[model samples]
Every structure is written in C-alpha cells, then in structure tokens.
Target: MPSSVCIMEDPPVDRLTSPILKKYYPCPNASPGYFSLRHKFRSLFQLPRIHASELPVQQNKPVSPADALTAAAESLQKKVVQNKSLISEVEIQQFLSSETGSDRLKRMYTKDVDGFQSPELWFIGQSLLKICGMTFLITSYIGGKHGGEKFAKENQATAFRTQFQASRLRNDHVVLAGMKSGFIWTYRVGIFSSIFLFLSQSIAVYRNKSSVMEYVIASGVTGSLLKANLGPKGMMSGGVFGSLMGLVGGTLIYGFMLMTNETQEQRHYWNIQKYLEVQRELNKGGD
Candidate 1:
C-alpha cells in the first residue's frame, strides 16, 4: 500500500463572515499589519474619542476662614429673610391686634415681661416679708416691755400649765419663747394671706377681669375659714374686717394703676408694637 500524503489548507473565508471573527482572523491575501479590534469595535459602536483637554477641569482654591464664615452667614441671612417674607405685614398687624385668653392671662400676670417676678411668687414673698416685719416689731415690743419681766412671767405660766420641767425663766428664755410664738403667728399669717391673694388673683385671671370685687370675695371667704375654729360670731367679725381691708388695699392699687397709666394690656401692646417695628426694620435692611 502506498503512504498517504498529508494535506494542509487555510480555514474557509466564508467561516470568517461575522465581523467579530473577521476582526480576530485576517484574510491570507491581506498584507501583514496590526488591525486593532478595539478601534474596529469603537467604530462599529459609533463611540467618539475623548481628549484630556476636552474634559472639565476643577481647580482647588484655598478659602480663608473669614470668607467661609461670611458666606455661611450670608446664606443663613438669606434664608431668614425668605422666611420673614412669608409673614405679611397684614398678618402681623392682625396678630398684634388679636388677644387670646392665654395672652390675656399672661398680660394680667405679667409673666414674661420686663423682669417682673411671677405673680404667685411675688405675692407670696411679699406676704412672707410683711409677716416677718410684723412679727419682729411685735416680738421686740413685747420683749422690751417692763424690762421683759411680763414676758418672763407669761413664759413661766405657760410652762407651769403645760407641766413642763421647770427651768428658772430668764430674760433670754422669755425672748426665745416670744420669738417662737412670733414664728408661729408669722407662719399662720403668711400662709393665710398668701392663700387669700393667690385665690383672688387666680379668680381674676379666670374671669379675665381685674377688679376689687374678686379680692373682696376671696378675703371674705378666707377670713371666715381661718376663724371657723371659733363660733359663727368670730367668722362674721373676721369676714367683715377682711372685707374692709381688701376694699382699702384694692382701692389703693386701682388708684395707683390709674394714676400711673400702667396697665398690663397697654404694656403688652407697647411691647408687641416695638417688636413689630424692630422686625420691620430688619426686613427693610434685608431688602
């Protein structure tokens, strides 16, 4: 048998009909050179080539602290101005003119105005101070009377009645005992007066009216209750005396307010007006 001759041939050109295959495999008849598959695909996809110069370049500039702060402040100010513009002058005027129940209460109490203490605390403190002064004066007068002999005698009598151990009652002991009595009286008076004033003020706030009548009613009720341990006659006497005192005090206060022309509503109005004016000035400056 004759040996068979080996035969070699190139792959068929028809096999490279696909663009991808044609890109990878060049025809045998073509010249020997590099054919970039990348460019070929780029052209096929219609992608444009970009140069470095055509790209956007950002330069890093150094900013000073002051400039940064000023920029931030300007932006904040602009935001504030925009917010303020949303509130019209007519709305502000309406808000200024209108008074709600809470506003009236705050005005009556003067809670947030002009460094004034709260009404409850102020009245209670005043009552405490008044009681303390009265107690000091009365105790001093009693202790000094008859060279404190009378007070010493009274202390002895009290100790004897109470069956307390006997100590030779001295002038100092008498003074101390008198002070104790004064303290008790002060506590009672201070508590009662504070309660009376608080009730009167609260009633006035509730009714949205400040007048003498509320004080009179509060004092009468408080006085009667304070003396309830006694008989009806004591209550009646206390109520009458309290009412008279209330009338005098209330009249004096009302007269003072009238003379000074310093009412809560008027003060609040002025404060609001000033605030509105300041805001208007700020808006004008912003504009």
Candidate 2:
C-alpha cells in the first residue's frame, strides 16, 4: 500500500520539467549561441553597421566644357582689360600733350603689341634654346650627321606663336637617327684623324680632330638650330651628317687625283729620303 502511494505522488510527470536521463542526453558540442543572434537580428527592424573602409574611394569631379570655356574666356578678358587700361592711360597722356586723334590711336596699339611682345619674347626664346640644344645633342648621337642639320635648319623659331604648336618638336625618328650619327661620326673622326696625321705629319690634326669636328659641326648646327627652333637630337643628326658628308666627298676627290707611291722597291728609298731630310735640317741647327 505504501509503494502504491509513492508512485501516485511522483513529480506531476511533466516531460519538460523531468530530470534528464543519461542515455538520452542532448549533444553539448553543437552550436548554442549561433542561431540566437541570427534569430534576434531577424526579429529586429535595424540595419547592420558597415565599416567606412568598405566603401569605394571617391574621385574629384571633372570640369565641364562650359566651365572650362567660361574660365578661359574670363582669363582672356582679364588680360585684355589690363592691356586696355594701360593704353587708356597712355592715350590720356598723349591727348593732354596735344597729340592728334589718329596719332593717339596708333600709339595705343603700338604700346599694347610691344608690351605683349617684350615679356613673351624673352620667355619663348629661353624655352626654344633649351629644346633646340637637347634636340641637337640627341639627334647627332642617333642619326650620325643628317639628323642634326635637318632639325638645325627647319624647326627654327621664326615667330613667338610657333611655340604653341605641338608639331614643332623632336620626333622619334630624329632621336633614333641622332644616336646612330654619334657612333658613326665618332668612328669617322678617328679614322680621318689618323689619315690626316699620316699625310700632314701634323700632331695637331690628329689630337684635336674630334674637337675640331665637333666644334665645326656644333657651331653651324647649334647656332642655326637656335634659329630653326629645332629639337637637339634632330639638330645633331643634321649637323654631323652634313659635315661628315662634305669631308667624305672631299676625300674621294682628293684620293682619285693623288698618285700612289706605295711599293716595296720605293719604300726604303722614301724612308732614306725622309731620314736624310730630317738629318740635314738637324745638322743646319748645329746638331
């Protein structure tokens, strides 16, 4: 009877509240908090925070055509007004000094043009010379001789307005040609100098030959290049090539006209003649 009473009082038989049986225990290794956050996020009506670094970098907005044109027009007007103001001042002075109407107008235009030319000319001249020098050097180095002179002659700055043109500069061909010229000219000068020394027996010819050629080529080419407003490399190609060509042509003419004295039989005779001539000259000086 006591056993039956214990069985009737057993803890209300609720499955959720019942003590866990060791045989049917749940897995402890499974994720516990993973689903909780996801569930809570789904239930909430808020957005997730994103880092600032996750956003793309922004670039500056480009200037519109209207804006650019407006800016240029405004800048030009400013310059024009400045010039006109100066002309007005000059005109007032001229009129006050008893100048005629046409004379005053002439003076104003002249003053403005002159004013613009003076400063701008100085700026353009410096830039032209620099570009020309570079063109000359580079061209001569690459194109041998022709490259240097062509630039030296053609691209010269005849007017200040030419600077604005992009076409008036060294091209790739001139530069490549200039490099070729440098190698060839150096070799030509060396061989020619040796020949000059042998013929004239002049130490000065052999020693200063390279400098002489460079100077000769550099002068006409460099100065003409200044006028041409050409690139340095192109100028170099022209000058070196031109001068060397002249030298080669001159050599060919001289070669055909000269008599050949090179013979085994005459070799000793020529040597003795030279030796005796030297001895006689020495003896005359009391050697």
Best candidate per TM-score, number?
1
In model 1, state the lDDT of residue 223: 85
What lDDT is reached at residue 164 by model 2? 41
List runs of model 2 lying over 4 Å from the truth.
1-164, 171-176, 179-181, 184-259, 264-268, 284-287
State each model's CA lDDT, in order. Answer: 0.64, 0.44
lDDT of 2 by residue, 1-287 (tens): 33222121112223323345212323333232433454466558667888999989989999999999999999988997654322334443443446343442243233231244222233334555554455556548556456646765775754445544524444554666766765555554444433332322122122312223333433334333433446776666655665665466445533442446432223323433443444545565674
- Please provide the root mean square deviation of candidate 1 (C-alpha atoms, Å): 21.2
TM-score for model 2? 0.18
Candidate 1 wrongly placed segments (more than 4 Å): 1-120, 140-147, 151-169, 231-233, 264-287
Worst 10 contiguous positions by lDDT, candidate 1: 1-10
After the best TM-score superposition of candidate 1, give how far the Cα of residue 202 lies from its true spot, in angstroms: 1.7
